[model samples]
Target chain A: MTTTTAHMSTNAATLSTPSDREIRVERIFNAPRERVWKAMNDPALIAQWWGRGNKLVVEKHEPVRGGHWRYVEHANGEQHGFEGRYAEVTPPERVVRTFEWDGMPGHVILETATLEDLGDGRTKLVSVSLFMTTADRDGMLHSGMEGGMNESYRALDKVLASMK
Target chain B: MVHYSTSLDSSFAALADPVRRDVLVRLARRDASISDLAGAFEMTLTGMKKHVQVLEDAGLVTTEKVGRVRWCRLGPRRLEKENEWIAKYQSMLEARYDRLGEFLERTRGEHP
Candidate 1:
């Protein structure tokens, strides 16, 4: 049997003292929610900005509950492959998915994205990933992801520019 | 070579908490008796015992009995196991990025 334990969570309420480990990132995109939503969904747009500047080949993608997603991140002749099932997917608003990298054991990362429309063309995307433990959270934070994420955003900016 | 994961599910389950993390952090500096460790926590001694048991189970700390004197010291292997697991993923990411750079270089040459 699989074991899953949840903390009191650093979300809306601080009810219990269940020790929590959390990571939250917020970004505002100049495009409208509908347009931003499309970029998140369209494979063409995703390919352009996914996984830093590496080539992302979405071999299979089905964004619905119980759907499976498998993609390969290829760069410099090496590949970082990851795949998982979608637990929940709400278009233009939310997506909950399980991520696992085949190369490493215990590399499971559950991710959640919440998008809010600011009534203007601008939209905000907040991503929170709940890792297995504090060590796991720190591993990602210290893994030099800051550069990759910034690069991904620059690519996204290019995508928005093309749409304009 | 120091990677060892003793299959004490309960012990690891207990170590998976922040309160317990605080206790382990304190214990690492020096060995202490039960009462001394419990005194540092807001929880009761009885409650602290449960946490101590978890640490013992995870093999992160050991409690010794010398004429009813229960002393605990940090068990270094448990920390090693966690770090080893993290290191594996890092190597994987680095390898992947190395390949991406080569691919980009080839594309530039061909287009030029």
Candidate 2:
């Protein structure tokens, strides 16, 4: 494994309808649906990539209906925590959960992820987040979380490119 | 932390309805009065006024009262913040998905 880089680039195409009730993000991965689902559900694998290269530690990951999960990310000597509960979970296909950033308690979002099998060992992932109010949905959009993630991706891309 | 201005929420809510969105598109191209909007949409004057009120509350439209006539125009830079906010998230999601792809590629042999 290459050392994680200090900067990251972003190329994610996230979209939120003007409805203010939901935000949908879609992407295609060069892996089978089952593999993509497993990578998302498995705590061990999640820890490796969930934090955008930050030192992520999974405390619990129960990818089953009514189950709960928690993970912490250590960045620059500070630990950030996130936790959520599963609303629905169907292996290799779909999972719905409630996500909340511990730093901003009470601001919870219902997130649903669906994996679609594309022939040739590929899969398309669609994740949608629903908020209680337009304000909450807009809040997440304006949080600048996306900007930070883009930076992390750029840095990670550089590190991976160097390995090749 | 997630934080959005109250006006942002109002703006989105105002834009949610098809009629309101059309109103915005019209205003974007040119200014019009409440009666003009009503006539264009085939809506009642009262109905148009309500819609205009919603847009004005959201700062999406500016209304000026000239004598007894109120002229309406698109609010300056009204959609800028919302569009920027959406664009950032769209790109961010793309990057995250790319990482998912990388992780899958690296762990394929191990998993399967």
**Each candidate's TM vs. the true structure?**
0.44, 0.54
Collision pairs in model 1 = A75-B99, A75-B100, A76-B99, A76-B100, A76-B101, A77-B99, A78-B99
Instruction: Quote the positional error of residue A161 for candidate 1 in Å.
Output: 74
lDDT against the true structure, per candidate, is 0.61, 0.72
lDDT of 2 at B51: 92
Candidate 1, B-chain TM: 0.58
C-alpha RMSD values across all candidates: 21.9, 20.1
Put down candidate 2 lDDT per residue, B9-102, tens digits, no spaces.
Answer: 7876775554676677677668998998888877789988999998888877889999888899977536653453343333334445656767
Who wins the lDDT comparison? 2
